[model samples]
Target: MKLFNRFPAIIHHDDSTTAPSLDASLPARKWETILFSTVLIWTFLGLCFPMYDTDFWWHLKTGQSILAGNGIPGLDLYTFTDADKPWIDLHWGFQVLVAILYAIGGVPLVTLVKAGVVTAAVAIGWRACGNELPAWKKSLVWIFPIICIAGRGNERPEMLSQLFLAMWLWIAWRSEKQPDWMWWLPVLQIIWVNCHALFVLGLIVGFSYAVDAVIRTRWGGRFGLEPRTDGPPLGAVFVVAVLVALACLINPYFEEGALFPLTLYRKFSVEKEFYRQNIGEFRPPIDFVMQFGLSNLFVISELIVWLVTAASFVWLLVKKGRWSPYRLILFAGYSHLAWQASRNTNIFALVSAVIACQNFAAAEVIRSVSVAGSTAGDRPHQTGKRVKLAQGMTGLFVILTGLVVSGVWNQIGEKNKPFGLGEAPNWFIHDAAKFAGRDGFPMRAFVAHIGQAEVYVYHNGPLRKVFMDARLEVCTQQTFELYNGILAAMAAGDPIWQNLFREGEPPVVILDSRSSRPAINGMLQNPTWRLVFADKTGAVFLHIDTATRLSLPPVDPSPLMYPDGEPKEKSRGK
Candidate 1:
């Protein structure tokens, strides 16, 4: 009786485990469709961060000024501390471009341009993953790299560098076969100088190409490499190199812009420790791993990259392949960059994709050969399976192309929607103009204190240059420390807040009551400051030094208070 009972139980358990798995083999067409949908979905998802990068405000504002002023502002117009500090607007060209787009269709157009620019960069990077690979494998390989870098593709000047880097890689590869196009490399520096501060990266690419060509010619046998006879003759590269250096100086800043990268890097670095350590992006990789654990996506992605890089080295060794010195240099350089800062991971992805995809091609090529030359017994309908697989992949590429185009347009729509959830709302912005009148509030006289970027955009600014904005690097190095100290003192109920206002007094103050109760509490005791506006997003306090403060009636000291006696916005969320 016991044996019989056990036998039935065993039979049921076996059936339960095996039955579901028996249907594991998905059809090739369905699998391809699933993968295509998943990747496209993720690519679109990557485009969904809210515009919190304060740099956008200043950049857009600067662009607007350039348009109105009919030239780049030769001084910093948006800061009190650095006002008229002989500013070098290296991104003058990009600012004008933004001005033109914003003028054309407002935020929607600017959002679309950001998406389109990054998408085009992604396409260039996908192609630069190298030749001699199936389109399917190349696309699949590039997808993950895109996912890794998707976080950094916000509407900023860095996207331009991403595009330019891809362009340089494309030219570098083709220059092997058509070297005459290499002459145009210097011409790119002219545009790059006016675009972003990271234009030095472009010069690095050109030099790497020149060095690689010289090395292969001199060191063909040592690394099992043969001189690529298809490449440009090595002798002219020296003359072109000098021209590239000279070309970088053709900007309005002239030598200042050309040397911006060096000066900026020096400013950020102190001995061995970087001042960028204060920023999350520039922190050492170990800090992220320790803080977020091994499961952190950034750490996971970095490990996978290292694995892929190691695999490439192994593949090269096994195949006795000619590893292009330029590719190797790029991989090593960018890998170090990632190790140094979590933010630089995208650059690593850009360069390592090339190294990885090339190595991956050899393995994929082998699989391709195996599929075409399969043995008889294992697959009874080999020819049919091959045809189905081919049709599936071809269909997938077509659908992916359509999805990418459609997805970018969709992303633009997502970005254009008014501030919701993670974004800074325009409530304060709309009201500031009404309260302050046409002339606007005093510049840097009172702290905006909340949603720094949103204030600038909402006001249609040049109202008052703020003490803090997302344009951090452009601000003096000590500005953050100084601002934080002032904020801390106010929050601690110290009298230092009064002194700060006396010295740097902004006419109006925007307060986040929930997080800033201490500061707000201190202000409540001060008779001179009056609360003119209050909403769920923030509270604005006007300093009543004179009639010039504004024509609004005197505000009561007591605000709408919650149970804790601190003022709470009727509206919720920041």
Candidate 2:
């Protein structure tokens, strides 16, 4: 109150009709309660998809390393190729979190935590959609956004970022009514910067609010509007934004961590061609849509929600006769982010849904509903019937959401992501991992599959080193190129592949059979390498010299492992 009194010109005035209070603590209507409950259940089930994210293993391992007093790693210790490479691990906080969760309950606990984080984020956004909108309308707008975000809902630190983002957005929205909520921004920023590289979003959200305050203050009087007194003072908001930005420097790396995203973006932009071609998340949504067609429900949901949000902006502009600068900036900022990377589509989905729902709430015309009289001009009976109909529709939508979660969204694009908990057994080359983790096995291996390499290193690292893993940021572009070259040569059955292998000096090679099928075939024909283990997921090869020195007999290389053929486990066959 004192802050607002000091700078009355900067407060925003709400011009909309008197509607239901936006307080979340207020008791929800019966239908709203039912709808929100069902939506959360649906969100939990949807995000509980099988853990196919291979990057998870490495992240968990890194977390364990941090917990073990090794501290947040400043050097690459997992891979032989990039040994001692400079690494600024911004995700140290998130890594420690997941590590602790895993220590408590292993993969099942991590899965539950992942589901809970995402469900909670969605719930926060749902609350921000405003209480004035009908329950059915809110749920309807929410369905597609939930579906869209579920595509990236695997176990990753980005999920934490999403939850934090939701919290920041809610704080920003409510700070007008509760000015002290703005102070939480800087505190959250300190946690966010150390957790994920996307922490800059907190600053962006604050900046949007501050700019909105400045604009409305300087120009509203000229446009024949009286000074508003709803929001916090402009100077206070600006101070908060600056404080939030400065909080980014509270990380372990301080200045470097504060500016790490820019450094990362510079590297990624330079190598965008490679990452875009190789990484599915980095690829445009259109690329997947074109390749997979409309069968991909996730892609379709993304498109629908995106288009509807765009229409919502137009609708609000026409109905209100003025745009909310805060919302416009959020819409544009997230729109550009989603357009650039498919990984960001989930965050964009949350923003778009909140904005669309809020717009509808603001644009809706208020009407009276008397307990003993008619609503608008309708008879009491008619109102009762409409209420029942809405209840039925909301119930039906909930059932359909369950069906989609259980059956439809199991797979996104070409990936086989089923709805469940725990890691997918087939995803990890477990047999090879077990064999490699043995007491006297070779310490260095050329890992052909990036995903398998992550798992392999988690199961066996420091004690063992890999040619490479999925730390694309730490690994040089030259290493990636050389790895690609080795894959190509091995696939072609060229003896030149042996020369490429010399660079890494790996005595053992491991690869996913499906991803590196041609290379497996080439290895079967090459006398220089001996197949020591083979399974459906991947195979392990020992150099002939290493096998001879160890007296390890080769597995039967007679039956060629075709891409379509499923081979039974083989170990040291006579």
Candidate 3:
């Protein structure tokens, strides 16, 4: 036993061994209590309020279809008009899981499920970092994920992608010291490729690992620091990359499913509306520079994550030797992503949090404190001042939690309305039964009566299938030009308005009042298209066709006008 203790350096223990006596290292019951408490607190604060623009309903619908034994559809199935259009089920696996959740419970259950998955992902990432982190620093990991959760709460295919990213990082870090562990890469890739289109990132990460391996091999021998390479390090990484690329072909659309994102990326470059439309994730942080109120808490949290990350990178270089080239490249990539949009800031925050914990845990300053018998540890520790500081901080957090529960946190409730127009208007259709009476209308419905209802020259919804939703980025350049042209023509009474809503146009057009003011105005200009029903939030436009002209009455223009003579202006000044 004395020899084992003295020769501890001979066998490399995992990083978690450093904190053998922390409360986090308690028995299984205590550990579970701590973990579950963290999960519950974060889930309530982060996942309970859904954000607008979360296409979760569509994902649920897709899952429902898959569960019904239809499997993954090769073409779009939700809309009647575009039912035959080619579509790829890129996120089939994730869809199936979400569908099962929806089927067993309802939408609320989805929140719980998402919360659990995200919490688990964060926990796994932290655990993978080992026990080198002190209790204070470890607690910060929970806060880090919370900062990201608000921006990342959307129910999209990317949720799975994010989880996969955490997993990949954990695995890659483990493989660094245990070369034999590289075999797990391919297995993870197989699952990732089937879950989300972001699996391409995994392939890129794998390729980087392989390149790093070759570099290490050539240089390590010269420096007397050779690592074991006989294991499947290079081979496993290569095989996984190839297999994951091929696994993308497992979807119903086969190769098209794999290539759809690339195609969309190319098409998105030329789209004007997509470029102008501010997705929560896409909006820049510059807008919040002047908002010094509590309303800016989310933005403030995001800025801290970015600033801390940048500082950590500098510290890593100055305190430790230069970081590995691969880590430097990954950090640079994250920095670029952070600048792209506010949403990308989550990625930066997560990466920064991990690096911060690792660096803080490994610092000589922290080690010296441990050796000096200060702070929380297994040894006889100092409790006169530092322990009191920790207890006071805990009390402050408890007060914050209490405030959050007593409706003070609900002040952010106004910001929590998920649907774009504050609430679903009376005209909104929550179920399919609402549309049964309007079967004669050739238009299709997508969640709450929002869908494409016309065919314009560049906007091909009335004739051809739409590339995606009514969002600007989903349409062709011509579609955006036509949309903008139509908007300009609305005030000028341009001839283009005549072509947009001719007599034989699509039977019905659903307009999202939150996003589509120009198209709605053009429809209102032409007398041939009438508003069947209008509400404060949204409206439905029906074509005055020969088949259903008598069933629909002339819409009262008075409802659409303000108390004054002017038309109710919907657009916020651009």
Instruction: Report the number of the highest-lDDT candidate.
Output: 2
lDDT of 3 by residue, 438-525 (tens): 4465443221212322111112222333223433223345544554554456435455545644444453444445456665677677
Summarize candidate 2's per-residue lDDT along 503-526 as a digit string, tens digits: 434457888866887788887788
Give one digit per residue, the lDDT tens place, for model 1 in 1-574: 1111111121122232122111122453354335434444445445544454545656777787777775876666656656657777788788788778878976556666775676666666655654354444555566556656665656678777777887777767656655565676777778888898888887777777777888888877676565656766766677678888999999888898789887655543442253454466667677777877775654666667777766776776577565667766777777766776666676677777766776665443333334336555544463345435545665655564454445553343323322222333433344543344345455543344434433554364555555554454356667766766666665565756566556545546666544556676666666666667654444566776533455756554444244234435545432
Q: Rate the local accuracy (lDDT) of all candidates.
A: 0.60, 0.76, 0.52
Each model's TM-score? 0.76, 0.89, 0.74
Query: RMSDs, each prediction?
Result: 14.1, 5.1, 7.7
* Model 2 lDDT, residue 493, Cα: 76
Candidate 3: global Cα-lDDT? 0.52
Model 2 misplaced stretches (Cα beyond 4 Å) = 1-28, 221-228, 267-270, 368-386, 404-415, 500-505, 557-574
1 or 2, which is superior by lDDT?
2
Candidate 2 lDDT at 295 equals 78
Give the lDDT ranking, best first: 2, 1, 3
